[model samples]
Target: MQTVGEVGERAMIALFTAAAAERSDNADDVVIGSGDDAAVLAAGGPVVVSTDTAVAGRHFRFDWSAPEQIGARAVVQSAADIAAMGGALTGLVVSIGCPPATPVDRVLALNEGMVRQTHRLGGRVLGGDLVSAPVVVLTVTSLGSLADLAPVTLSGARAGDVLAVSGPLGGAAAGLAVLSAIEHGADPGLAHRFSALVDRYRLPQPDLTQGPIAARAGAHAMTDVSDGLVEEITTMAGASGLAVDVDSAAVPRPDGLDALAAELGVDPVRWALSGGEDHELLATFAPGDVPPGWTVIGAVGDAGGGPTVDAQPVGDLHGWQSFSET
Candidate 1:
């Protein structure tokens, strides 16, 4: 297999751009596509843009996940920001930096993964830059539009609003724990028994459509659970100038999470509350106006204590912090 150095930067750019163009759907919103100086997009209203970066060793490992999975994960986490704001994905600009010794096929597969995911979420790969670096780094800039709806923000929640989540939680965190255990020489059978959790950690399939649905249902505030449930709610409560009461029993959990947690001697609820990377939308809506697919887990109240689950103060449970050494 040829390395990226063998293909040269110019040829690699051509290859990546071609791959993105082929997978992109014909959309009226995209005026200029890949291989351009900059992408031109037709917007119906204010454009909602977001960017996320994934670094090798930190965000992913080649031995643990395929190039395709890594690529897909990048798009999912990036586009989720658009969804959290009650917008639909329009296009993406992905910048890739990797060592010259990286396999050419790996980079191409990564592009394919991104394009396929973008297409799946109603977006196109517009343009990006490819550079040589010491390790693989993927930066995905996602563009979106809210059409006729107003953009949902973090400070919109009011007292009496109901708090809900779009989908299951803790799966990603649990999956990470399982993968870490396996990497450290745990029984390989654990992989087969907990494949679902493993898959969740590798490639999270968050429902981006729920953001718009929540907005239409009159969500007051919304944010994605990239860090963890407890942390996100704490942020929302602080931003909204109100307190949130989370009913621990109401947060959804992935199937087999209990069993796996038991096997690992960990608390499943802890994982659900503090696990990050699920990318599920956490929003506050008017009571009874909660959308069909969302589960009501709590309610907004007057500010006092920060946030609580089961009416108890949220003490030690926390989410992923980028700067923290823990």
Candidate 2:
């Protein structure tokens, strides 16, 4: 079997280019796609760009997730960032670092995963780089088109705005807990009951369409739940000079999360509030302008120093930070 070193960088690029081409619609903006040294993109108005990284043993494990899942997860998170900015995805540039001894097939599968996920949002992989490393490291930079829409920033939130989320929260964290339990001798049968959570951890499906929807609905500020809910809300509050008050009872949890939490002797609400990587959109809007799909969870107040949950100040408002102790 050929390893990455044997197949070489050019060959690897060829594989990725072919995979991207197969899945891409060849949009006119992507005039120069993956085969080139750099991709050329044309935008009618403002373009939003964001980048995110995933690493082996940190972001994921090959034993727990397939290469495709890893690729999709990386792409989804980056796309979610663009979505958070109230933009529609246009293209992606993915760079990968892996051991030279890694199998070429694994690399191809990773590229396929990125291609597949981008294709789902009507986007394509424009270009990227490959390098040898001690472990797998993937970085994705996503580009989006605003289409003349004003970009929403965390600073746009104001006092009296309502807080809401576009989709379910805490599912990814719950999924991680289940995976941990299985690793430590928990019953595998439980997997049948929590399959959605497990799948979510492996491959998060962010509501990419919601970003533009929220923008159209006049969202004042927006962010994705890449970190825990409290952490993100706090960041937004701090940025906007407002105090966000979350109603814990109103935070939406997945359908079976309560049952799974009961089985694990964990608090479902805590997971919903503190779990990261859900990639759900959290936005602040005028009370009467809350979008149809969003679930209202809280309200913004004049800056009283920080954020609160149920009228009390929040403690331990931390989330996924790279290099922080797990």
Candidate 3:
């Protein structure tokens, strides 16, 4: 906690550097992990490194989410970050912090889940750390290579760019709602849809294949919708200094989203806008450059900065903050 509070990402990294200097194997390749906006890894090709964390109760609950599901979820979200960078997943380093009283079987199950998801997402765990904490906090860093390919960024989008999303939204949101409802003793129909939502929460399909496809198609800018659709679109808009107008109707919502929302007495649009965890790709394409896997959703506009849906402003326009108490 002191490392995170008194020190930022840089200073905290320096502490780790001092600790790792004692190790003999990684003496040379640990370049620039202490100072940059991103870390430097000595991959044969362009470096691709991304980090993600999953916590108990917020990101996962043991009673509702199984051990294997929680493990796989961690790997999926981390790999999604690399894919969002238009990089292929080559390796993952996992760190797990759990209470000492936690069962050994549960730990093994979690590792199995991580292995299964890593293989499914085209990656493997190169190394990891284990520590004791009050709750399970799993952090994963994924490394990959661009292989002489250009790195796609979230800031390349331009005005008049056509916006596209690769897959349907609202699946994970719907599933989470179902699980919540069941816990609260809601009706069966509303609760039965938990399977689909749980799938989104557990096994996020990051379209590992489409990042390169979008790049090949001349995508102006691209990102994964780990946050809700509205929030991520707005992020791209901010990064590119433009406004993104998403046609809400153009978003391909998955099966049972509306009815599930109705049962919860909530607006489906809210889930489509604010509810995150659906890790689909949202990108902007140059005119006549829409890729095969991408679906056109909206257009890049000039005014009213940040992200909007059908010309209406989206809430907050940011992804889930791990530290914000508000």
Candidate 4:
């Protein structure tokens, strides 16, 4: 098998550029696609840009996920950020740092995954960088067009607003638990039983369309649930200078999660509240303005307190922290 080192940097660049060109839809916004010094893109309004990274061993294990899944996850991480801002995706710039011994095909496969994801959001791969690193690292920068709409930020929420989520949560957390179990020799059968959860951890499918929908429906504040629900809401509360009350019964959980959690001897709701990486859009809307496809999980209240579930403070709920030890 040919390695990246054997193919050399220039050849790798040529290969990636060709791959991007083949997948490009030639959107009107992308004046110049990949293979250039820098991409030129047209935007009608304010642009929303977000960058995210995935590192080997920490974010993902090569043995646990395919290269395509790794690449797709990176795109999801940044694209969801644009969506949370109520913007339409315009383009993505992806950079990769990998050891020379990494297989050339793996990197190409990774790019293929990113291109496919960008295409789903009506975007193109504009440009990126390649360099040597200790481990395979992917950094994707996603750009979106606001289309003249005001950006929905975490600070826009106010007292008495309805707090909702675009889709189910806890699936990714449940999946991670199952994967950990399998890796530790708990039971190989668990993988077959909970493939959906495993897939969620590998590549989260956030509803990019719902962000704009909520925005149009008058969302006051919005954010993608990259961190756990509790952490995300608390942060939003702090930013907005308000308190939030989450209805424990209203939190959405993926089907069969409770069963899996029971089998694993865990509290499923804990995962729903504290597990992160689901990427579902969480937003605050007026009482009468909550849009379709969103579940009302809580309500915003006055300041001087933190988030609560069942009217009690959430104690020690933890979510993904990049710098914290695993």
Candidate 5:
């Protein structure tokens, strides 16, 4: 187990470059690959860009998550932002910071995870920088192209639009709760019974394909559910100058959540509303225009100034804030 200090920066860069080169399905816009000062990419129409950072202990625990899982998570979340804008991915630029004592194999595994996830979306890593630090930090910047379609903005929702989601929600938040319980010495059988929730938290499978699908289907507004469902809907409503009315019963909760919530003695509906990081696509569409995969959970109404569920304003609306004391 060689440490990063022993391998040195140049050697580490070579290792990462080789790993990135293994991804064969790079987009045609990737004119220049890794091992350069900067990557050169071709742009056609509007270029959508987004960046996200994940810090160890804050975003994840090394003891609970494999290095690859951490890496995959960082990539997926950043890529989901591009998808929210209804763009097809072009490439990614990754920058990693870790302690010198970190194992070289761990860094390599992290890169492998990034490669695997990016390749899944028909993209590849262009280049990145590795720096010595006190803790593990990964920053991924994703670039995408909108082709001929207009990029969906959060303010495009009309008063009569329908609010829909591309996939299930609340699974990641439940997974987080399960992991915390396991850390506090919960029964192993509990973990075995709800392994799917744990896996959802470990590595979220965001429906990246649906972003473009929703855009093509005439989605007026869109955003990713990285924050809790209510928090994001509030943002959309505020931006669009409309009130969003959510049918509490119509909101899609993940499978096995009711049983798990009962065991934990918590409200499953609250989890679905407030639990963040599901990374599902939340979009607004005209009546009867929602794509086949999206589930209509609510509707937009005349500006009542905020979001309401079951015709009542929600209290305690909060999600994954970078500075919140959870």
Candidate 6:
């Protein structure tokens, strides 16, 4: 086993998990698998289930993201995912893996984060398990109940639907750029410029409340902006075999984004178009207008169609994928 910051927390957990995956028993009563936050059953009333994760090197860094931040972020993100399905969270569970040499306080800090985030989202931790690993990994699962039978789906976008987004864009992209530059040994002054954006990326302001609002507002299709806008728009368009047209000039820029873009030698538009992990909600509506906190960005044109900025093609329809190099 490597000792003392020899490897990132995520790598250690993956190694240990790989070893553990082989030790599974056939008799374990897993109503669901070991991926999402909470498992499900026929104890059913249309439960909303979601899973979120924080890795040592990828999702967060111990040197940057505090232990509590990791826990809170995991819970918030999982809760956001459930809310995307128009479900209100009822409970949370964390499956935590940590190095043996890790400080116990850090673990407590992690749990504290979950509790804080759970309270923020109006939920609580039911129970969970602790395990030994080489690095720190947190996986939070959340369960919610659907008020109505209507569940928002990304694949249900319809042509002529209004394409809209809740909250600002380019912020998370700005933040992630900071983290990546820091990892590459950038100067502290430059990294600090991305602090807010980075925090937004690490602790996303998932539009949990807005999801149901959109669902209730005759939303034809809906999803969170976990991926970049164009990528997500393309995802919905492709799912419905429809085409999307976006007005690049219409997207609202977050504060400090233009300055940050100039500092990083990037286009604010590129960040908005191709950025990922913002977790803002992107929904399609056939109604005449937008709900609160939403901005009109474009319209759905045809099936298998793509976005047009001022009637021009946006960036390549593909957004950044986690395992793929951008």
lDDT of 6 by residue, 1-326 (tens): 34423555455444433332333333132344333354433234777887877778777777877787888778876887877776777666777887767765677677777766776776655556567777788888888766774898878877788898888887877887887787788787775766777788667776688877887787888888777888887777778887777787788777788888888787888877777777788888885857878999988887556556666766464576768775
- For model 1, state the Cα shift of residue 295 in Å: 0.6
Worst 10 residues of 3 by lDDT: 1-10
Clashes of 1: 0
Residue 59 of model 6 has an lDDT of: 72
Please give the RMSD to the true structure for each candidate, in Å: 1.0, 1.1, 7.6, 0.9, 1.2, 7.4
The stretch of ten residues in a row with the least summed lDDT in candidate 1 is: 20-29
Of the two candidates 3 and 4, the one with more favorable TM-score, higher being better, is: 4
Model 4, runs deviating above 4 Å: none
* Local accuracy by lDDT, each model: 0.91, 0.90, 0.72, 0.89, 0.89, 0.72
- Compute each candidate's TM-score over C-alphas: 0.98, 0.98, 0.83, 0.98, 0.97, 0.82
* Higher-lDDT candidate of 1 and 6: 1
RMSD of 1: 1.0
The lDDT, on a scale of 0 to 1, for candidate 2 is 0.90
What TM-score quantifies how close candidate 4 is to the native fold? Answer: 0.98
| Model 5, total clashes | 0
C-alpha RMSD of candidate 4:
0.9
Stretches of candidate 6 off by over 4 Å are 1-44, 183-185, 191-194, 306-317
Candidate 2 RMSD computed on C-alpha atoms after optimal superposition onto the true structure: 1.1
Worst 10 residues of 5 by lDDT: 21-30
Q: Cα RMSD for candidate 6? A: 7.4
